[model samples]
Target chain A: MKKQLMTGVLATLLSSTTMAATDITWWHAMSGQLGETVNTIARDFNASQDEYNIKPVFKGSYVETLTAGIAAYRADQAPNILQVADVGAATIINARGVAKPVEDILVESGYGFNNQDYIAGVRNFYADSNGKMIGMPFNSSTPVLYYNKDILAKVGVDAPKTYEEMEQVASKLKEQGYATFSQSLTPWIMFENFKSRHNLPVANKNNGFDAPATKIMINTPDMAMHFNKLKDWSDKGYYKYYGSDWDANQTPFEKEQVAMWLGSSGSFGGLRNRVDFELGTTYLPYWQSMNKDAGRTFIGGAALFAIDGKPKKEQQAVAAFFSFLTSPETQMFWHKSTGYVTVTKAAYALTKKSGYYQEQPDAEVGVKQLSLPGGEWTKGYRLGFYSQIQEIMHREFDNVFANRISVEKALNNIDKESQVILSRFARTVR
Target chain B: MEQRQQYTHSALPYFLLVPQIAIIAIFFFYPAAEAVYLSFMLEDPWGQSSLFVGLENYTILFNSTEYLKSVVFTLGFALVVSFLSLSIALLLAVKANNILHGKGAYKITLTWVYAVAPAVAGIMGGFMFNPHIGVFTEIFASLGWDFSLYTDPFDATFVLVLVSVWKQVSVNFIYFLAGLQSISYAVNEAAMLDCESDRRRFWTITFPLLAPTGFFLLVINLTYAFFETFGVIDTLTSGGPGGGTTSLVYKIYRDGFIGTDLGGSAAQSVVLLVLVLALTWVQFKFVEKRVHY
Candidate 1:
């Protein structure tokens, strides 16, 4: 019995010395080249730290990974960190004990993280109702106008700025026998980015940032004009609606069949490589002719959250890893690797000093589009049941674009349908 | 019956039954019980927390237009997939059986399609039918027919149905070939000597004899269409062009897993369970009398 006790103690000591670094699993959804970049980030962070080891597991797509993390948490095997899409921020936060607030992590650790260093639009998205950070903004992207220079030159326009001007330009280009624009019919550009660009409230109560929004504000007159404009222009062959998302939308632009393509900044690297045509990217068109209070767009990618119920040591290790990711140097590598927007002001400044933007001007467009001074509605919208809401939005858009209903009726119907989801979600959360 | 032997050791029987019972209990009963329990409760996606809300989830599902539409959609999809796959496979098996030369080669070629994954088959269909890049779409365009699967609901559903039928044809084909081959050549020669036409012999003599196999395949194919067509639908259309192809199973996955409406999704599953149970029961009760066996 004495020998057995001594052997157990010796084994414990051996493990303590050999396995000094605490293991913290990180579940993420990045795939392909972006997946490689995620691994590189973890490897760099692991090399930087002697205390914590982060193991990044690729868990399918965004929805799949988020579901896996949640399923893990339910099974009492959740990882230390989970990378979930920005849409899931509210869902994760609202879930009573699913995630540990990043701000709380920093406060407890007393780590010197300058919150002000984060870009305002990106930072505001992951903040809670009290303006406290809940998730780390990682690989954030926003839509930009990708135009063919040759087509714009033939049409005698530099770059269209407002909705009305774009309409005129599209007409001119079509008259010259070129289809003016082709966009992915996904809700990211049509719903979220459009709302942000026009400073319109997509939902009530400060776009659901201040509190759980009680109503959807997508039926406002400003929203109608944009849809109406798309309707009229689409009737005149000014636009082509591709399949539901970015990869599908890039096909026409890659084929040089369309002049204008509005898509995510994350596709910048691929867009540059695929197109032989002289490509020029500009800001997503605003409705300056309608709403003068329009503001800059917000981020569209996923963020990292420190999951709850982890050991204290594992939590600190996750916090340390997050700090390393948020550093300017690591952020630079991440931005260039994925063509996602730079998350930190210091990172942007350092990239500027490095003359990366001057070397590749296409990378500068998304930053310029999103880094504008804030307006009343500049902060992004978050609500529960957004996945359901997104599907409804797609269906309602088809109603208008497919000639089943007028834009006016479609808008009203969508509002009513969205309210049903909102009310049901309100009940579920309560 | 006359040679039946009773087990002298009762414990031996229990020991022999242990693995099967344990497996069924663990794999099937436990999950079913959990789903039934969750169907009555409002829960988070992770099942981290739940509120017992009685039958509210079922009520909400009943009231939901999307759920109602998906029910009709699932019925139509299963009907189309089952009928098309069975009929097409029957026709192919008949043709292959009629051919005397290279019969093995013909059967082998047809059966090889089963090796392809449903998603991979859907993707192959995409390569053929995609409007922008498809060779078939290009042909249709030249013939003055516009084809855009992504933009048209019927086209989207057609693509899903086509891919699903393509994947399932092999299983149906194997069953059908066995059934067709089981019919004796002596019967066919006798029917011909009796002066019956080829088509008439197939319809009047051979088809009735094959009804048992047909009845068995009908049940299997319906189940396959109802439960196993998710990969095809997801790959080709993602149940879109506005939920045109969203079956009951796909909707459950989207809501429960992707949309994170656990209670609602569970409620959907319970409703689906009752539906399938009723369907299968009716098929077995009434349809079995038509079988020759």
Candidate 2:
């Protein structure tokens, strides 16, 4: 009789404990090591509070997860939280009734969300013209130059600070029967970074941040001249075209086929594990003459968004989870483990105070590169139908790289196609 | 034609037909109807509100040069994949049917290729054609031709078509093999006694008997090339070296699912449905008459 009574009491206690905790689902696109970090944040947050639980789900790539989010939202089944890439910010912002701005959600709940606490470039990337935080920046990154130290020593050349010097070094490397540089042909490096590093305008309205719509101004003499140089380099067998895939581009560099690689800052951890030779890191190159006053590099990683139209309890739980994720301790742990830039200033200061950069110099390059003051264009490009516009850029670039079209034609094509997409998106928003 | 037993009650026929009708209604007709409905409206990513946009979506797609290019590309791709897969599989099936020793082994080995998913086949193709570290690239380099598929549109599209054909030949092989097995040995023996060339005998008797199967396989192969090669194109070229290999189905998937352009993608899907439907009808109307069975 005493055992039965004890069982009934324990069952009742379990049910009540479950009732008190509101579960908030976070659908993210982080995979492999980064995926582990996502789960760790959720697990820690759940363990810290009995009032809420965060459920982490892996939903393939950014495009797929964004598509999934859209489908679910249409069905009124969106998760409480979502992870959207930097490129998708414009679309997410225009999702009027779908995504609740992180600032709005926290403010509504009477929770503290300091917009100024995040790194300036990150804050700008996830903000609107009013600098209102729409998404909480997480796992943000930028492109950096990675070189094989052995090749650098053999060639007797220091790291390049400008595009002109990079060409000279590449020419020397090519003469010695070595491929000079390889990189994935992405807009981050091919289009946006070049514009940012050169201090050139990517669009008419400061990379589409100042207005609801903007026309591209990238069809200019600066871009054409730079790509003309690239075309010449390609003809000389110095600039090898790696496929437009990130993982595929890494193989040529890791196998010592290419001496220098321009890749994502987040790739630091993986490259360290795989390469047998000592590695060197530096900021991306600038156009010395045209870009006398260059700006900071643009970021490429994703951010956390609090989804809209959930129950009040669930929305509160999501706000609690965001605070947990952006905490200095959690951000620092995430930054150290994945080589992604820590989003918060508190996390940045904490890691620096611990002398983390002194030990791993390569890990600091991304943070240092983005530390420079950023204007509207330098914050990053954010435009609706960005994925479509990106594809258009890729297609034009591909044709140019294949020698089917001149750089002038490619840039012209990109400008024309992008305007159409932007105009369509403008209509949608209206 | 095979004989069927007559059923007395009309209810029994309708009863037997219920499950199939229900399945067709739920799975095929319902989604198709929804796709048509969606094609007429501007549906945002989050489906909170969808506006009626009339023919704007279709007009936009029609005006885009890339969409038209994809139409021509898909037609060329489907033709090549269909012809090559059918001819190659038929030749192999003929050889395998004749071989008395290790026939099952040969058949099973050829059959297993179909078991591989389209995406897996594409990934395998990617490894072989990857310019940076591919074994085939090295081999071609040594032979005085630098066969890099990454930068060249022709090379990339060729790989997409080749991998898709490699995946589809297995299904064609099974049907052709079954067709070859159905022919009686006695007929061939009787023809041999009359003293004609073996090649001529095959042309006159065996080939004609295989027409019904060939026609069936051709229709299936064309449809496979048109509709089922999306994953192969995705993993192989991603519709580049400059949209060189973007097929109709692939564009629909990219626009609708990846880019989240619901109205645009739905419009494209509706067009694709009509195109395939007309093509199938034409094939049945003109080509099926020649089949001996």
Candidate 3:
């Protein structure tokens, strides 16, 4: 018995010495080149630390990854960290005990963390009702206007700043036999960006930040007018409708068939390489009469969240890894790699000093637009099932452009349909 | 009187059936039974909490215009895809059987598409029907047809049906070819002697002989349309332009997985299960009896 006991003790010591670092699994949805960058970041973090090791797993698309993380949590096989989309923030936050607040994690781990270090729009997005940080902002993107400068110069007009100016430019381009604009028929651009920038509430309860939003306010006159304008533009052949395919507009934009393309900020790095001509980016157009000063647009990418129920040591490891990620050097590397916004001010400053924005001026447009002062309505949506609601918005709004439904009718349908989802989500929350 | 052979050792027979029964129970019965149970309750996204809503999910689904519309679209989509694929496959098989030269080449060329996965097929179809760069779009445009699959529901549905039928035709072709070859040469000669027209002989004699294969393929195609074409619809249209092409299964996935409305999605599954069960039963009961061996 004494011999066996001695052997066991020696084996424990040997194992402890060899397996010193705590293992942390991070499930993310990034794919392709972006996925490779994620691995590099994790590898660098692992190399820098001796106490904690982060293993990043590519878990399909954003929705699939979120589902896998939730299902894992239920099965008690949850990862230490999960990367969830910006829209999924509300759902994850509202799901009690599913996540440990990142702010708390950092403070408890004794990191000199400041919430103000993150960009305002991004910081507001991943924060709770009481303004506590819920998730560490990672890959954030916003909508921006990309215009073919050659085509615009041929039309003899700069990129539009207001809705009326956009119409005039569209007409001007139409006369030149070029389609004026094209965009993804997504609520991220059409609804969320438009409403938030105009300081209009997409839902009651300050776009669901103050409380659980029960009513959808998408049918406001400002929104209806915008849809009406899009329909008119579509009818006049000023705007090209590329159906529901996300990458359909890229061909037209690259071929100079369309003068302007409203695309995600993250697409800048790729668009720069794909196009041979000079590309210019500007802030998303707003209605001048509605708002003299436009509010900020919401972020559209994913953030890293520390999962609950992990041990304190694991949580500390997650915090330390997050700090490393937020550092200016790592953020700059990630930004240059994936074209995602540098989440921290220090990172943005470093990127600027490195002459990235000077070489690619369009990359700064997203950061500048996102750093604009945000109002209560512009602090991103906190409604549950927002991803599905965004789908509904896209579907309904696409019908208007298709001439199958009127703009008013589409808005009415969106309001009614999204209400059911909101109510169901509210009920499901404990 | 004829004596029927029976298993003398009942335990051995039962043991022999255990693997199949166990697989069916674990894979199909368990999940299906769980779906039925969950359909009657409202569950949260994380499944941390659930409420016994007692048929509220069903009521909500039945009352919702969107859900009902999805059901109708699913039925219509299945019928259209199955009918189109089977007819096209049968026509190709008959033409190939009649051709003496390059029969093997034709058979091999036509049956190879069965190797492509549904998702890959969807992606290929997506590129081919892309509004701007797609060859089909350019062709249709030159022909003065506005074939924008992204904006127009009709255009999207057309592309979806076209892709689905194209992907599904290979399996149906192989089955039909096998069925055609299995027909006795004597029977074909007899039909040729009796019939004056080739088309009439094909319709009257050859079609009846191929009825068993047709019936089996009908069930298979319907099941494929109902469940397997999800990747196609998702990749092609994503059930958009006013939910014009959302199949029941697609809607279930969107609701259950993306939307995270578990109870509602479960209810949709139950409805789909009932629908498929009813369809298969009716086919077996009413249609199979007329099919000759």
Candidate 4:
């Protein structure tokens, strides 16, 4: 009777162990190569572990994915993990109780939480004012200058070292019948890149990353100067305004109709397979007459946040996945596969030691550009209504480009709209 | 007995309308009521916490220069596009009605063009007018004109209006043709016997007879101009050349979805809904009375 009871207990234990493996849903916006990379990582993790199984789903683009997640949340069917873009950060933050802080998840899961492991510029974005990390650093990237070497060589213009040099090269390229120096005039490229390269403040409180209630500083002298440059170039037919965002302007670059393009470094992997010409990567140019050192470019990619309202077991699983995601090996795999900068210092060191940079020079540009001192603007601006500000800036800048208004008037209008939005956002936060 | 039978027959029709009423109540009326209710409330990023703020959204909208400008812009666009499309469609329909030999072929061709979605037509039109590779751009440049629709607000608006008319004219054309065909040949004979010229007869008799169709087309074209052309704006200009082409619906999309200002967007949407409803009612009261039928 004792032997039969012992056998029965062993059988029940085996069945319960089999049933313990839980499936967690992860909703992401990545597709194509990036999507495959996410799936591969999830597969590797699942294979290595027997307790939790992660199910990855490609929802859509960043906005679409976020909208879908919100809809799902309304229906009480949200995913366990969501990858939100940098622009969506404020929205997520404002969505209190809807997201679990990564720091809390890590601690609860018994993992050692180290905020110092992440790059300061990147980590600061995911952290609250009290210095608690809110999200996991996933694929962080910054904009860089991408030039067609053949076109540059033909125009006798070496890769532009300064904004003035870039202007001169654009003229030469236009003279050589290139017709367009750059395809797209994306607001981020025009405003953020220009602001960071000049070390100009886009807002108070270190471009709003230090304080959320800070107002916009877009109508400043530096911004005016930048606008003037763009306007002059546009008038001179050196810059062809593609109208609106970068996606609309990508056609010309893919066809080699444009000489230069300013876009995220994350595009390197995708462009590598498409472009027929030699693509040279360089740090974004600054005002030549301004200070020689402007620091690193501002980061412009998304991070993964652990949503709130899940069971402790699920939170523990998410934390383990997050920790594994930021590990050096995983970072290297992500960087090599997607051209996004590895967020961790250890990953960068590993890449250096492995001589990956020597093999692929394009990957080195992002690291070198980000290794600079990252001044006030380069720290990555965060505000409650940045997306609105961006839209207003783009609208006003487009007006400037169209000669509908003077650069001064456009800047003033941008300031006015931005102030209104900022004040409204401040009231809400309070 | 006959009066009782007529009452029972009328009751069947009322019973038949019940399902449609249920559908409209569930889908349209409920959401519209909810939008109005939410417009008076403050919204957050998560779209969860909404607090009632009586008339705050409307007051803010009324105070905003941007919102006021968009209102004017949307009104101008809707009026201009509707008139242009109706006039062109009426002319084409009349011309096709006069043609006896190839009217079928003409209608088939026009129908094919109309069958193509507005988005596809907008894309094709964008490429055709694109400054870089567009044939129209080459021609305009050769004529010593700047003619860059992307850079010029007037030019962008012109392109939008032209595309809007092109996409909508076919539907109105069919309506006009149907109206013309339904008119008895006896009316034209009587006008002729009264010594009215062909142009005079058309203006006095045929045109008046087509008023009902015109009114219907006006409502449809105006709504299409307001809502359906969001794709055209998105694909062609994206409300650019400095918000010169941002319609009310497009503004709602940009604010709500792209800018993530749900409260402001919902408020804007409520404003748009009210404007549309008011205009539609006015059109019905004034214009619909002109329809003889």
Best by lDDT: 3
lDDT of each: 0.83, 0.84, 0.88, 0.80
Q: List the residue pairs that clash in candidate 4.
A: none
Best by DockQ: 3
Q: How much is B48 displaced in model 3, in angstroms?
A: 1.7
How high is each candidate's interface RMSD, in Å? 2.0, 1.7, 1.4, 2.6
Task: List the lowest-lDDT window of 10 residues for candidate 1 chain B.
Answer: B1-10
Q: DockQ values for all predictions? A: 0.51, 0.58, 0.69, 0.38
What are the models' TM-scores?
Answer: 0.94, 0.95, 0.95, 0.89
True contacts kept of 1: 0.47
| Pairs of residues at least 3 apart in sequence or in different chains that clash in candidate 3 | A243-B150, A243-B151
TM-score of 3: 0.95
True contacts kept of each: 0.47, 0.58, 0.85, 0.44
Candidate 1 displacement at residue A160 in angstroms: 0.6
Tell me the RMSD of model 2 versus the true structure. Answer: 3.3
**By the DockQ metric, which is better: model 1 or model 2?**
2
Give the per-residue lDDT digits (tens) of candidate 3, residues A284-400: 889899998997898888889899889888898999998899999999999888888999999999999999988878788888899998887877778898878888887887777
Query: DockQ of candidate 4?
Result: 0.38
- Estimate, for each residue in B1-293, the C-alpha lDDT of model 1 and write its tens digit: 44455434469778999999999999988987878888888776655467888998888888877778899989998999999999999999889999989999989988999899877888888888886788988998999877777767887887788888989999899999999999988988898898658888889888998899999999999998888888887777777776667899999998888888887788888889899999999998899977767
Candidate 2: stretches off by over 4 Å: A1-8, B1-12
